[model samples]
Target: MTYKSDSHIRNPEDFGKVVVIYGGNSNEREISLESGQSVLSSLKKSGIDAFGWDPNQESIKYILNQDIDRAFIALHGANGEDGRIQGLLDFLNIPFTGSGMFSSAIAMSKVLSKKIFLEHNLPTPKFKVIRTLKDLKKATDIFGFPIVLKPNSEGSSLGMSKISKLNELEDAYKAATEFDDVLLAEEFIQGKEITVTILKNKTLPTIRVKTNRTFYDYFAKYKSNKTEYICPGTSDISEEKIYADIALEAFEALHCRGWGRVDFMCEKNSIPKILEINTVPGMTKKSLVPMSAQCKGINFETLCWTILETSF
Candidate 1:
């Protein structure tokens, strides 16, 4: 394919042909903005017409009026990654990066994702969805103590808590309820924290995340350097292959495409259990997905460009 220079261009896109959707009504707005900026910068550096569009009043109106060819999603949590924006882009007939509506919806909801994983016979921590406080005990009975209590439909670990003792369950339950009506009392698998980043329906590289803290909580994940990550996960080639295989299967199982990340808990028993899938993985300098992608000779700029080019 021959490329044209600016002088030879008939009509160049000044405002950019690629619109980046970011910073919506999500708790992760700050990180989303960071991701948007980074992606925009990389796209611009790579000679692609790209610009950031926060999902605010003005941004929404402008995009609806504009003629961008495709969109790059940088938003996370809530209306951003919960299939709402994907549905909107679909309505506009604009091809955007990342999974589609059904896949985004399923991956965003903890309850729905766990169900799919369970149905696929994938190793995921067993859990019970608590419809009411009265059902907490039934959940604990099924999952046992040291369980992770999380809202069924939230992301970025917001309103998620790990209850090790019986006395901690109530408070954790109350906290998690602030985010959603339904909650999952997942059986906490005491082991290593790991993640898999996928792009274009392929697994990038497995990362074994080790934190100085007990687990990779919200604080440790985004705030503190309490975490240590091992690309390909300290596993031998064969073991890493196993993880990559499972990760790919889970990604396909969730119907994820374009790009996404799946998290897992690696137990000492050598069984890696599914945690959940992040349709919109963070793109900050410290994000894990980029780390995995970098392991395969794909820099952040190149990675962003590849995803954008695919949108065409």
Candidate 2:
């Protein structure tokens, strides 16, 4: 049986073959809903048996409580993207899409990720994770002004602030704590903001984010209409290839599976530095992964189906 909805694609066959785990009691509920809809649409189109589940408080119980062979995770932020839910799925012996617990954990924490990147000789922005305002002055002096303060374990640019003066450090720290305790202040790199989507060790393409805003904060990332995305970034094939290779290598180093997206910052030299990795990237209409995939002839629906097929 085929059923079509507002998203795109056919309904899943072999009903109950796969279950899509989505939504949660997280603040990013709207994005999660959009992601869930996209996944549901694609899963259905692929003729697979899949259904959507919120997995709210008792997510583990929710999965085991139901008859689900496999899970396609569509949740974002905190409980969903932070590896807690992935760990639950693992314990339940349920094969789920996206990276495993360890990978998700590393990707979730910015402080830990930068440490790993440095140890692995991967180019990443120098950052300091300050636990209190006492360490703020020291960190700022080292990283210098124009620092980006964000939660160590948050995504979607939530609780992110750019401080160019010492007086703003306190406010930035306070705002960042709204998301997580250890606040990360990275040396604000003045360059192009790039996003790379990878699947099966293959980096799709380089997407350069252009926004009228100062940095690609929450507004520029999710809300602002002033931002423009160039799928391939530039006409320079050499730079694009370099970014793609670096992104693929970074993805492999992080032990990501199936599909993921990496964010990078490129300096004037065209050197792309690792910003972070998104295990369960957004699949909404304006998401970077889908946009990058579409550049290579894969629509949002097909890109999602490919991820499902590859993951399980």
In terms of lDDT, model 2 sits at 0.79
lDDT of each: 0.80, 0.79
Error of 2 at 138 (Å): 1.1
Which pairs of residues collide in model 1?
210-228
- 189-212, model 2: which lDDT tens digit per residue? 998898988876678877889988
Q: Whole-model lDDT for model 1 versus the true structure? A: 0.80
Best model number under TM-score: 1
lDDT of 2 at 100: 83
* Local accuracy of candidate 1 as per-residue lDDT tens digits, 183-239: 888888888887888776667778988878656777888899667778877457877
Provide the lDDT at 44 for model 1.
Answer: 85
Which portions of model 2 miss their true places by more than 4 Å? 1-16, 57-62
Clashes of 2: 7
